[model samples]
Structure formats: structure tokens, C-alpha cells
Target chain A: MAELTYIEAINSALREELARDRGVYVIGEDVALGGPFGATKGLAAEFGERRVVNTPISEGAIMGLATGAAAMGLRPVIEVMFVDFITLAMDQLVNHAAKLHYMSGGQLGIPLTVRVQQGAAGNGGAQHSQSLEAWFIHVPGLKVVMPSNPADAKGLLTAAIRDDSPVICIEHRALYWTRGEVPDGEHTIPIGRAALRRPGKDVTLVATSRMVEVALEVAGTLANEGIEVEVIDPRSLLPLDLDTITASLRKTGRLVIAHEAVEGAGFGAELLAQVQEAAFDYLDAPIARVGAPFAPVPASPVLEQAFVPGAERLAGAVRKVVLGA
Target chain B: MTSELNQQEAMELLRTMLLIRRFEEGLIQTQKSGISIGHFHVYIGQECTGAAAIALLEPQDKIATTHRNHGHLLARGADPRRLYAEILGKAAGYNKGKGGTLHATVAGLGFLSTSALVGGAVPLAVGAGFAAKQLGERCVSVGFFGDGVLEEGVFFESLNMASLWKLPVVFMCENNSAGALGQSAGEYPGSTIATKQLIDVVAPFGVPASAVDGGDPRAVRDVTQQALARARNGGGPTFIEARTVRWPGSRPLWPELSTGETDVAFAWEPDRIPMAHRDWFANDGLIRYVRQLFDAKLANTKEILALDATVRADLAKAMRFAIEAPYPDPASALDDVFA
Candidate 1:
């Protein structure tokens, strides 16, 4: 195993994909110039200009071109820089890439991966801080993945590169510096599965992205308070691991959904519906969700802290579900 | 230079044009009778243009078109019955009843699927052309669009990229003079001049371009032939502007809801120019040659109509099969969401 940061793991995954598949290529606005966040540093020099291409400031053209290239048997790992910029290419993603397979009656496959930084990190407020995973997860034909740690970030992205469908892989800018133990060689994490971070019996906590790490922390603190918490990290939001959640709900009988996105209309609503429908009878109490408030992420640090959900909010939700607080 | 096509080849072109005209006329009638449903855009006046452009292409060459695409599809040799059934929303349709008139596709037939969104298919052709060049297939990718799509920035970007890459793509602008009632070429003089100057601007980028009379199918065909030959020889992309007149709903079979009171009077007028052109040919005792050509075209179209009927019937059966095919299990809805 090698100690690597999230950004390093991503760079490593890109290198491996490029070396392994001749069809793979990368393109973005500043990708060749070491990327906007230096995630692709030295890639252009190592792989040459053709494989690591620098494109004009046309997100729509970049994505449309990538979709067309992927359909023509090229594995394009497109970096849109920020998830917010993905709005510019929504038509191509929504109309063409996502619907091509089902609309074409299975004649085409879009094996393209769009890499973007998602969720709030540091003081990048409002425009840059929003997490839009729920929007993509709503689309049917796309695979939405939000990796919380370095290991799964590399493994899941590699698998996404090789998959026969379009994958929207979101990484948080905050997690890029966080370190983890990733395998030395090639590895892959299946897209639809969830990972159990902390096993407990009192209450089940489901989280994604950076929220997964916070939920694990809260579970540890909750254990000392005589209340055990089970934490489940859904690596992929689109292909949700309902089997894992359903099994955990059967044991705990209490659930708490958490994410960095605002509380209302977030992925929390979808998870609540799924768990309530499948494991409704096993519930000892109604499920609770801890998330950002239903408002834009504020610019001030104090307001930003109040806006995002953290371990304190999650632990409070677990206490409510478990101790009837 | 113009004598490459013999009389036989010329006649074949006319026959294809007639086939599209008659098929569209029939569809207009059927659609009005409630036999076919949903949005149906006919390319009546644009027949000659499509026939001519497609005639230049070999069966292996690929083409992409916009939503107003029946003529283009028929010109590219799509089976009329499957297209008709598709318009009728039958399971045996091109997209198995899912994609209607706007989204009909037959990929294996070298008609790479069309995008209903304007200018969407143009960039796709660039990628296809790039792939064809990489594979050394000696094939050219053609993109067909109306005047409305020029307003999109991607159109220029596509031209620039395709030219820079020296990809074999034919970007044909069927400037039909109208983008749904607003005069197209007149509204945007600045862009029009730019578009008019595309051939010169693109030449230096390694891609050559030209414009033609879109109303004249013969002219379109000739231009396409040149473009394809240039492309196959690795001469890069070309942009052609086919300046054609839009015959506003010439097929009186499908009348607008606003034309309800005067529908019968409208039907009495002959919207097809060929029928009128035939009489003009006859008054000078040149009727013999015209009659012989018209008779052969009618015969060929009748044969295609017979096949169209069989395909429609087969598609009806397929529709029944799909409708009764059972809705997917609700539980399965939760599946395939992630991976």
C-alpha cells in the first residue's frame, strides 16, 4: 500500500488508465497547464499533448465532443474543472449521453467519465460550493459517484473509466489534501455497492462524500455515550446500495440520512422513500436526516459552518432517533 | 464537366425525388386522417435538394440530419415502411415506437442517429468523420441543418475544429429562407455575411467550403459529389450552403388547425411543382419524353408503396407485442441506477 492524497490518487488513476488503454484521453480548459487544481500536473509532459489535450473555454463543445468521441470507441476522461460548470453542458449530458443507449435501442454505449469537484470546501462560497450530485442522480442513464476517501476515489474512477456507460464522478476540493492508504497496484470498486464504515446496532447512518467521514466520527463519539451507530457510505448516488441499507435497517430499526446538500429536495428525500418503503415495518421510529439548511451556502465562515451538516448535527439526529430526545 | 451523369443516372435521381414527394403526400393524408399521431414536419419543397445530396454518397458513407428529416432519411435509403410505422408509433418502428418522427434512426444503414435539437448532430458528424479517418475507411460524414441552427455557436466551433483536424465532413446548410415564419437570411445580415464567407475563411484552416442552390436537387447532388470526392481523397471538410425555397406546407393533405375553413380550397391547388412542370413540358409537344419519365417514376413509387404497406402491417403487430409486453417491475426501477 502507498500513502497518497485524494488528488494524487486521482492523478495516479489517470496515469494508469492512459497506460492501460490506448483509447483513453483527457481534455479540459486548463488540464494541460497542470489543471485548475493541479490534479493533472505533469500529465501533458509524460503522456504528450494529444492524450492530455487542452481545450478552449467551451464546456458544451468539450462535453459534446467527448460524447461523440466515446460513442466512436474512445474512452474520454473529461475534466469540467468544477461541478458548477457542468450546467453549461447539461443539454449534451441530459439529451444525448444519458439517453443515447435507451433511445437508440441499445445500439450505442457512451463509456465517458466526467470528473468535477463537488460540495463545499473552505471559503469557496455560493457558486463554487454547491454539491449537485442529487441533480445527476435524478437522471436515469447516468452513473453518479462521490468518493469520500483516496482509496475508493482511485478504485471507483478506474472502474468508471472501464464501464460501458457514462459516469459523473464528483470529488470534493477539500478532500484533495486528505491522505489515505491506497493499494500500490491497480484496483477497482464496483459502482453500485456501498461500504460499511462503522458497524453498530442502535441506529443506521447513511452518508456520501465528505459526509461519510463525519458520520464515522459521530459514530465513534456516539458509541461512548451508550448509543451505537451504524455508518454506511454510498460510493455511488445513482446506483444506490439499497440492499446494504435494507439489511442495516433490519438490524438497527432506526435511520439517519446525511449529506452536504441542503435538507429539502436533496438525496435525503430519495433515501427516506426507499428505506421507508422496503423496511417500513422494521422501523422503531421515523427516519431523520442531517444536512445543510434549505438556503444558499453563505459567504461568512460562521454562516457557512451553520449551513453545512457536521458530526454534531448527525450525532444529535442519531440521539433523537435512538434516545427519543 | 457536367456530363459525368448519363441519362440513366439523371432519371434515377428524378425517381428518388418523386418517391420522397409521393411518400410525404401520402403521410400528410394519413396523418390528417388520424392514422398517424404527433409532430410531423414534411420536407416537400426540399425533396430535390435531399435526393441530390444523397445521390453523391456511396452506401458506406455516413450522414446526420436534423428533426425535419423524412426526406433526408428516405434519400439515405431508409425503409419507408419502418419510417411510416415509426411515425405511427408502432413497436416495429425504427426506434421500436419510442422515438417518433423527430427521432427516427437506423444506425446500421449508415444513417447515424439524428438529434432533434438543432445543431446537435453537426458536432457528432465531426467525431464520426474523425473516426472514419482514423480507421482509413475512405468514408465521409455529412451534417444537414436548416438556417435556424446557424445562430448556435457550436456550428462555427464544429466547422473550425473539423477543418483544423482535416476531418472529412460535409456541413450542408439547407437555407430554406424561413425559420418557422421569421425570414432567416434577412434577420441576421452580419451572421449571413459571415456564413457567406465561410468557404474562404475555412479554406486556410485546411477545410474547403462552397454554397449551392438548395432548391435545385441537381445542384445539391453535384456539390455533394465534389465534396465527397474531395473528402475521400483526404482533402479535409467542406461547408455547402444549399439556397432553397421553403414550400410552406405544400402537401395540402396535412393542413394547419388555423386553415380549417379553407382546407378544401387549399387541397385543390397543385403544391407539387413537378406535376405543374409536366404540363409546361407538354404544351410544346415535348410531352412524350416527360410522359415516359413520369410513367417510370410512378411505377417505381408504386412498388415502394406496396412494400411500405407490408412494413406498416408488420409494425402494427410489433406495436401490439410491445404494448402487451408488460411494464417493467416497480422493484426493478431501483436497479441500474448506479452502475
Candidate 2:
């Protein structure tokens, strides 16, 4: 095992997948130049331009090309510069890529992986910083994944490239610089499974993507106060590992769900509804949710800082759920 | 210039156009008789464009088409029985009744896929060419769309990328001067274009463009051959705009009235339709091609009648097979939704 940042781990995964399968290739805007965030740095030099392709600034055409290439026996890993731009390609992704295999009556398979970077950072403003994982989670025939750490980023991406269906991997901009220990080679994490970050008996804190780190920090602070908090990171959102969350909830009756997206119509609402349905009788208190207010991400530093939920907000919610305030 | 055709080639072209014309007529007759249901776009006047363009492509070459795709699929050699069954939503259809008339796709016959959305198949053909080039395959891919597709941004993007990458693809635009609602697309309220010639739109991308008479099968076949040859020789993508007209009977058939707004006077007598609108019938591409065949003496009156009889008998058998085919089991609806 070696310590690597989230972006480095992602690059490692791409290199390994390109070397392992000749049918695998990368295509997107500026992907050959390592993209805007440097996640794909030096890939073109290693794999050559044929494998690591650069495309024009056309999201619809990029998605269409990837879907067609995937249907014609190539495994393509396409990247949209930002998650917000996915709206431009929604028709191709939702209509063509998601429905082709089923519409063709089992005659075609779209083994394409679309990577999108979300969450607010660097004061990138409203158009560039919105978290749109909820849109993909509601779509059937699509696997939605959000990796919380460097290890999960590498392993989940490798698994997505190998799967025989369409998958969307949402990577947070804030998590790119975060470092963690990742396996040396050939590491793949199974989709639809949640990872337990911490164990506690007082309450369960369910987090996703960058929120996992905040939840862990809250757990550390609560540990000094003799209040235990268990953190569960749901790696895959669509085929959610609800059993793991329910098991943790069984141990700790109180629950607090945290995410970076808006509180209205966010993925947190779905988790809250499902948790209540599964473990209604076991809950000692009503579930709590921590998310951004119903507003677009701001451009100013102060406004952006206030807009994002942090460890302090999560800790406050955890205390309220535990103390019945 | 139109390509020169020998006797055998001229006969085959006429035969292909006749097959498409008769097949669409059979569909209208069956629908009027209450044997089939669901809406479909008929390629009545535009049959020559697809028949001749697809004739230039090999069986292994791929082509993606729009909603008006029955003619293109038939021209690419799809089985008549399976295609008819597909329109009937039968278990024996090309997509096993899962995809109806709008989304029929048979990969074995070189049909990559069909989209109900206008201009949706343009980039898909470019992608097929990109894949073939990466895999070192010697086949070219083609896309068939209408004049309305020119306004879509994806079409322009596809042309630019195909030219930049030097991918072998042919963009065939069938300009029938009408949109889906039977209105002149050029005169539509929101339609605005700077160039009167469709070929000029792609000239800025450095791709060779041409226009031919879509009413003549020989003209379409010759132009498509030159485009395909250029693609095969590593000369990159080419754009061809075929100017044609939609027949008056191309709309949905209504047999209740003898002479209504959407009704044809001689529904059964496709051969005797007048050659001009002044004679109460529009000039059709299939009729023009058939006349050329007779004038050239490539097919005598006896041979033309014999071919028509064979096509009618084959279509009758296909309609019977479709009527008898079983419906898909309801429990299997959830199947094939994923790989």
C-alpha cells in the first residue's frame, strides 16, 4: 500500500485499466491535457493519444460518441469537465446510454463510465459548483457511485470500468487533495457496498462523498465528550447498502444524514425516507438531516463558506439527535 | 453528374425502389384493414434516395437512421418478414417487439440504430467511424437525416470532429422540403438559415459536399459511390444532400372517404399516379425510376409485371407471418433492461 491523493489514485486506476484492457480508452474535453483539475495528468504521455483522446467542447456529441463506441464493443471512460455541464448531455446519457441495452432487447451492452466532479470549492460560483448526484440516483439502469477517500476513488473507478453496464462516478473537488492509503495494484471495491468509517453506540452519522470527512471529524470531537458517533459512507447510492446502515442504526437508534447538496430534493431525503421505513420502531428520536440551504452556490468567499455545511454543523445535528433537543 | 449504370444494375435499382414503395403501400393497406395498429412514417417519395445510397454500402458497413427508417432498413437487406413483424410488435420482430416502428435496430444487417429524435443519429455514426478506425477496420459508417437536422448543434459538432479526426463517415441529408407536420420546413416560423444551398453549411469544416437529384435512383447511387470511395481511400468524411419531395400519400391513410384532405384517389393503383400536381397527384421518385427502366429497355413490360407479382406475393407471406406471430410474454418486460 502507498499514500496518494484522491486525484493521483484516480490517475493510477486509469493507467492500470488502460494497460489491462485494449478495449478501454479515455475521451473527453482536455482529457489528454490532464483535464482542468489535473486528475488525468500525464495519461496521454503514457497511453498515447489514441487511448487518451481529447474531444471538442461539445457535451452532447461527446456523450453520443461514447455511447456509440460503447455499443460497438469499446469500453469508453468519458469525463465532463464539471458536474454542472452534465445537463447539456442529459438527453444522450438518460435516453440513449441508459435505455439502449433494454430497448435493443438484449442485443447491445453499453459498458461506459462517465466521471463528473462536483461540490463547491475555490469559489467557482453557481454554474460550476452544484452537486447533482441526486439526478443520477433517480435514474434507473444507471449505477451511481460517490467515493469518499483516495482508496475508494481508485478501487471504485476500476470496478466501474470493468462492469458491463453504464456507471456515473461523482468525485468531489474538495476531496482531490485529500491523501489516504491505497492498495498497490489490482484493487477493486464491489459496488453497492457501504464502508464503516467509525464505530459508536450513541448515534449513526450517514455521510457521502466529501461529507464523510466532516462526519469523521465530528466523531472525533464527540469522542472527547463521551458521546459515541458511528460514521457510515455509502459508496454507491443507487444500489444503496441499506442493510449496513440499518445494522448501524440498530446499534445506535438516533440518525443524522449529511451531504453537500441542497436539503430540498437532495439524496438525503431519500435516505431519510428509506431509513424510517426499515427501522421505524427502533428509532428513539426523529432523524436529522444536514445540507445546504435552498439556494445556488455563491461566488464570494464569505457567502460560499456559509453556504457549505461543515464538521461543526454535522456535530450540532448529531448532538441534537442524541440529546433529544 | 449521374453515374452510368449497366442493364443489370439499372434493373436492380428499379427493383429495390419498387420493393420499398410496395412495402409501404402494404403497410397502409394492412392498417386500413384494422390488422395493424400504431403510427409510422412512410418513405413513399423518398424511396429512391435510401435505396440507392444504401446500395453503395457493403453489408458490413454501418448506418444510423432517423424515425423515417423503414426504407433505409429494407434497402440495407433486412428480412421483410422480420421487419413487418417488428412493425406489428410481434415476438418475431427484429427487436422481439421491444422496439416498435420508431426504434427498430438489427445489427446483423448493418443497421447500427434508429432514433425518434431528429438529428440524434448523426454523432452515433461518427462514433462508429471512430471505433472502426481505432480498431483498424476497413469499413465506412453512414448517417441518414432530414433537412431539419441541420439546425441541431450536434450535427455541426459531429461534422467538425469527423473532419478533424479524419474518420470515414458519410452524412446523407434527405431534404424533402417538409417537416414532420407536413409544413414546408424552410418556411416554418422558427426556421432560419443563411445559406440556400445545404452543401455550403459543411464547406467551412473542410469536408467535400455535393447535391444530387433524389428523385432519380441512378443519380443518388452514383453520388454515394463517389463519397464511399473517397471515405475508403482515407480521404475523410463527405456530405451529400439529396433533394427530393414527399408524396401526397405519405401522410397517414384515411380510407373512410373517397377523396378527403389526407386520402389518395387511387390507393391501390400506385403505378397510374399522374406525374404532376396539376393532374391531382404528385410526381413520385419510384414512378420516375420505373419509367426510366422501361424507357431504357432494361426491363420490358412483361419483366416489370413479373417482378411486381413476386414482390406482392412475398409481402403477402410476410403479413401472414406477422399476424400469426405470438406476443411477447408480459413477465419478460423487465428483461433486457440491462446487460
Please report, in order, the local distance difference test score of every candidate based on alpha carbons. 0.75, 0.85
For model 1, chain A alone compared with the true chain A gives a TM-score of 0.98
Best by lDDT: 2
Model 1 C-alpha lDDT per residue in residues B1-339, reported as the tens digit of each score:
124556576556655665565566666656666554566677755666788788788877777777778888887777777777666666566666556677777777676657888778877777677667765788888888887677787777777777767788898877765564445445442234455443454466666667775655546667888888888988888888776554545322343322121111121233532453433222211122223334445324344345345544554554445334433344533443322
Candidate 2 chain A worst ten-residue window by lDDT: A99-108
Q: Write the per-residue lDDT of candidate 1 for residues A68-129, one digit (tens) a residue.
A: 77767788899998887889888778777787665655566688899999777776788889
Q: Which stretches of candidate 2 lie over 4 Å from their true place?
A: A276-284, B1-8, B184-192, B251-271, B274-282
For candidate 2, please provide the TM-score of chain A on its own: 0.98
Native interface contacts kept by each candidate, as a fraction: 0.27, 0.58
